[model samples]
Target chain A: MAAPESGDGNNGAARMVTLISSDNTRFEVEAAAASLSQTLQLTILDGGGGGGDGIPLPNVDSATLSKVLEYCIKHAPAAANGGAPNATAVDRAELERFDNEFVNIDQSVLYSLIMAAHNLEIEGLQSLVAKKVADMIKGKSPMEIRRTLGFPDPTPEEQAEMNAHMLEYGWAYE
Target chain B: MSGTIGVTLEQSRSRTAGPVLPENHVVSEILVRLSAKALLRCRAVCHSWHRRTSEAAFLLVHHRRQPSLPLVTFLAAASSSQSQHSHASLDTLDLRLPPLIGVGWTPLPRLADAALYLHGSSGECHILRCKRRRYGDHGLTTNAPAYHVLTIGSSAEPRRIELASNAPRASTWWFRCSERPGILLHGCLHWALHSSPEKLLMVFDTVTESFRSMPSPITGTQERTQLLEMDNTLAISWMDMCETTMRLWLLQDYETGVWTLSRRIIFPVTEMRSVLNVKWCRFYGTVVSQERYVLLHDSHSSYLFHCDGEGKLVRKFCWSGAVPRPAGHIGSQRASSGMSSSEGNMVLVRGDNHVSFKASRV
Candidate 1:
């Protein structure tokens, strides 16, 4: 754990700090709030920052990190508010809408999010990303699967083996 | 656009120093996208990936995702004794089984000098046996043997066959049992080895030739034994001690070749006097009707309350109402009707219902 005093002082809320991405771009956020990412949480807890300085994230580039932080900012509040008391019909609909919109992403960004979520121990993000990938590839043939995932073509023998084994699993309905 | 090579000084360095992830990252990315079959193939790609994909839990989870197809039963029969001219006397009743639709009983193949058994489904039959010879007193016999078991009706051919004869030129296939011989069910095979009277049940494999010995799940002190099938699930009924209650056992798992206990259904034992003779009480197979109702009858006119899946008596009526036979008496009925599929249903024989009629169908 690095001491918070080592970081450059940006905002002094005593409970908030700034996160500097790999590109040196900085965003002010509550220290308790930025700890949503398990990776960041450990670093912040060990660093002992009274929210007087900004922490540096060398691995996460500015654009992807900013998108991740935006997700945290929106989700952190509702979770802190103790979630839904009785889960009314309207609350369920609103949460569903928010989840749907939050998961929309391009392929590269989605892949990056999955990797980051896995590294950061973010359960919600990991499931959303894995489910999205599974849904896209379901019912697709091997060739289509390769194309969709940008996988390289297999050798002829490898292709033949796959076809033989998957003979029973192929769905005629699709 | 500015990040392209040679477009700007900063872009050129960025392109040269960019992090290129290893092939494993790509492999991981591809793994989650593969189908169940595709995932299985992914193992041959490398040893590490193969170990991960072949985990039993993973295969079970993957298999659970697929829809469960209707199970097909496979039955095989073979003669137990070496009697050359005599065939084992057996009676096969194709009662109006509801789960099975069409059925007019087809005459099974006559036993040759060799062992013989027949397997059937709906309207089809297949007789599987090893090649054997039947010699005439005139000393006439064929020098060659038949290679395959003849098809009696509609069942598929056996995957393999064996002729266990001792002729110098005879070739036999592999089929072995170290202890007791196995019992063949409608489409499955089972072998029951008894450690004691209490621990008696059978174990069998539906797909493989391997035999498993299992313990019976029935609680003893039951007066009589009854076995019932509800949608491929086997339920056994027996009377508990004191002859005042009936205990029913629903089988839970069949994969391990064991009849696991699922539920224990109890009923207040009904008491009735026998009209013909005051014999001991016994249990028999249940007769389920088209209305999804199960009618359980004991000896004589003693009819008990009818129960559904939940053990609740849906209705109780005089046993004579269902059958025109007189109450408090044992009577035999013998009338064979041409069994049809839809409109013309065959009458089920009750209380020692015997089928002595020959099949009119060839």
Candidate 2:
């Protein structure tokens, strides 16, 4: 569905685009925010996702798409200003606070976001989610990390292998 | 609503099993952000994880992502009770963490009755010890020297290598003289050997476990010469005792042994006049922190002299109070040997009988 007025004609008004989630949910967002995704940037530049023609992201679900859009919207302005060199300390601090809170989500949602971010080629989102995953895995043993990442318990052979590895790299545990 | 939206809205969501396993590339991207110690532990995660983490390409990526802090190892005088023959122990200082608490001192196998000579590069230390054996004219042994290399942190026991064949004949005094610490660059440990009429650079390649000699960048008799690594290149700073002039030379090309004169500084005779007033007073200058600082030690005291990239002295301060003295020997010999990493964050100091390690930033 298209908006009644074409905001593309006016330079003052922010350009808008429609994104279709994998679950077929339609969401409207500003073109600047959507452009943060390298994959969508080229399509948007080529006049795709204009008016009512929504860009379909087949790899991302509606919930994950919404979360990604939230990040893009918040980061777009600062990213446009080239990391906001002139931005006040409070503004930069607020953005950092927002980023810290954004990644604080359920493990399943975080995994979905990582997959979505990778598929969409969103550099910032990919790094952020990847860092979150790394933090969770930090200081955790192999088994603990496997469980944290939702991997199934090791089989007998795999358990034996892990035991051998632990014995060989015993200093790592220390 | 005007333009057509091509995709038809699905009323029901597609059911999926669970979170898909991330691709190896994605996993690598995440793992690269981890610290070296963390990644070492991560090798036990699984077969694929272990293989991926240990790959040379992945290790290079990890090193670039998280550059390792310099590790300093030196020889310290071992306690008398530890061994009846050997006099020294090995100590390691991990500059990546905080000082004092981060320093680890391990008592290695005894040096026996031999004199210990040490040089370290790339966090590995090569220690050479020699004992002279005397032989009488009638087939009785009196004094002949045998050299051995003490391998630290290796699985195998320390073995003896032929020192007479490997060592250059011109610099035989290198074993007896007190010299500056070795500068490690390009996988080779370099130390300046000053022997009266000739000066030679002793290069030990860690990969090949061999020793080679390169001509000194400066020829003729120079009072003091020190080897240092600057911007991944080998650099030498030598002071002419007669003229009290210091010159810094950088090895521009390693293959042809091409050296470019970087800087030359004339000592402020008026400022150092009081300190150098005595006839026997000898001043030793060593490049401590690459091109930033040079440690100058006189017979009685030591001072940290700040210098520019051009080797010009900017300012000087008495460093006796600031520099922590080595644990064992304090006043026996004035000659002190120390080396700093390329980044200058880590420093290892060796005195006559003691060794001290320090890090500026954690």
Candidate 3:
């Protein structure tokens, strides 16, 4: 129980920390869950974001912050157990399934998730999103990769250059 | 390639807290996660990407971040009117997974005679020479190789590692490593040497660059024994002559050489009662685990079964690459050696997490 130092050990709400997103939206979450982010862990550990004062995340929008909080909440228990090696296969499969579904989002939202994960220093979220993006790159031509990953369609000049590069470096193409 | 594609991207770009592929740090992080082939193709994306991904520093980081994938290589001896072993080639079976797909592979260095087999894992390569009567004349089979060469990517000269003089005659015994390469675990390469009355595992410490031996506690006249890295500890999977059953033994303590019978993997096979009820089946012995189930993949039989920790058959996949030579290979490699009917010498690199070979040549 991460009750704030200010709490007299009776206030039930003392276990929660409030986070303020860039859009000025306030989100109250368990200190254990919020501590999943290394960026927020210190503040949570120091009893900094309790009660009236909330940790400010100026770089994360409200939409992304909510998503990040959802992930942190889901994974906090496993992280608290120090990656619980004794976790049953069913539990691990459940977490893996959760991880697989978490990243199945719009490309735009995926990029946002990566940035949020990176900025908040969430290693699990960072790797999950990176793996998702890596899957899109495999077995696809450069043009197809750009198209699939939501990159702006290359102009004719850029397309010509890419073709030329492929021709020049045989290993770069299939 | 339409308005729908970059619509969200455009909206995200308007916000202050967003990243695109242009962000070198973010992009580099994603690039390093790609498979070896996909990473190569990424160079064609642009001149800048080629320049950035080609840097030695980036490669070092990629190698470190490299999710160890199972690499399967097939030796295709180019059929010629001359000699069978003279004109041959070895290339990796490029099957990237998590979805179990892929099409092509870049050919590895072409060996003139199919004498040397290269087994690489976690960036270290062990060049093993197959046992042949020809090597005995050169005083090779008589003496073991005493060098562990270290060559950092693209370095001209490789630093020769000094192996101890007591390094037993490992060439003939290690050649059997063709079926099972030396498993690298806890900063050492382990090879189970089943030579004589005494069976021991040869451990080559990467840090110390020296050799040490650990005697195995479990003994079997069965011949199929491989050192596996199970959950980070040393484990050996051994099957009897019947070939229908396998016993997995876990080393409880590295210091005391204690062994524990972990699980029994009963392969789903119909054993024929040969002559005097001495049951027999073709060879099938290699264990690779998934997150939930342990999949024992027989490289020779080309049949893979996903079994529980108790080794109960949960599901199975028929992966006999009986279709055709996988895409990107130069010629066909027929399965020979007077054993079972093998299409090619199928070898999967050790400790691969994303290895899921389905009904495709992928």
| Residue pair clashes in candidate 1 | B73-B187, B74-B187, B124-B154, B125-B153, B125-B154, B200-B216, B201-B216, B222-B239
Cα-based RMSD of candidate 1: 18.3
By DockQ, highest first, what's the ranking?
3, 2, 1
Estimate the TM-score of every prediction: 0.41, 0.55, 0.62
Quote the TM-score that chain A achieves in each candidate: 0.77, 0.91, 0.86
Interface RMSD of 3: 7.3
Worst 10 residues of 3 chain B by lDDT: B331-340
lDDT of 3 at B232: 62
Per-residue lDDT of model 1, residues B62-131, tens digit only: 4333321111111111221332121111111222223222222222223121111223332222222234
Off by over 4 Å in 2: A1-11, B1-23, B79-362
Question: How far off is residue A171 in model 1, in Å?
Answer: 6.5
Interface RMSD of 2: 8.2
Per-residue lDDT of A1-174 in model 2, one digit per residue for the tens?
222232435366678889999889998998888888999999998889988789998778788899999999888878777667988999899998998999999877887777778778899999998899999889988888766765556668878888886786464566
Winner of 1 and 3 under TM-score: 3
Clashing pairs in 3: B71-B349
TM-score of 3: 0.62
- Candidate numbers, best TM-score first, in rank order: 3, 2, 1
lDDT of 2 at B123: 38
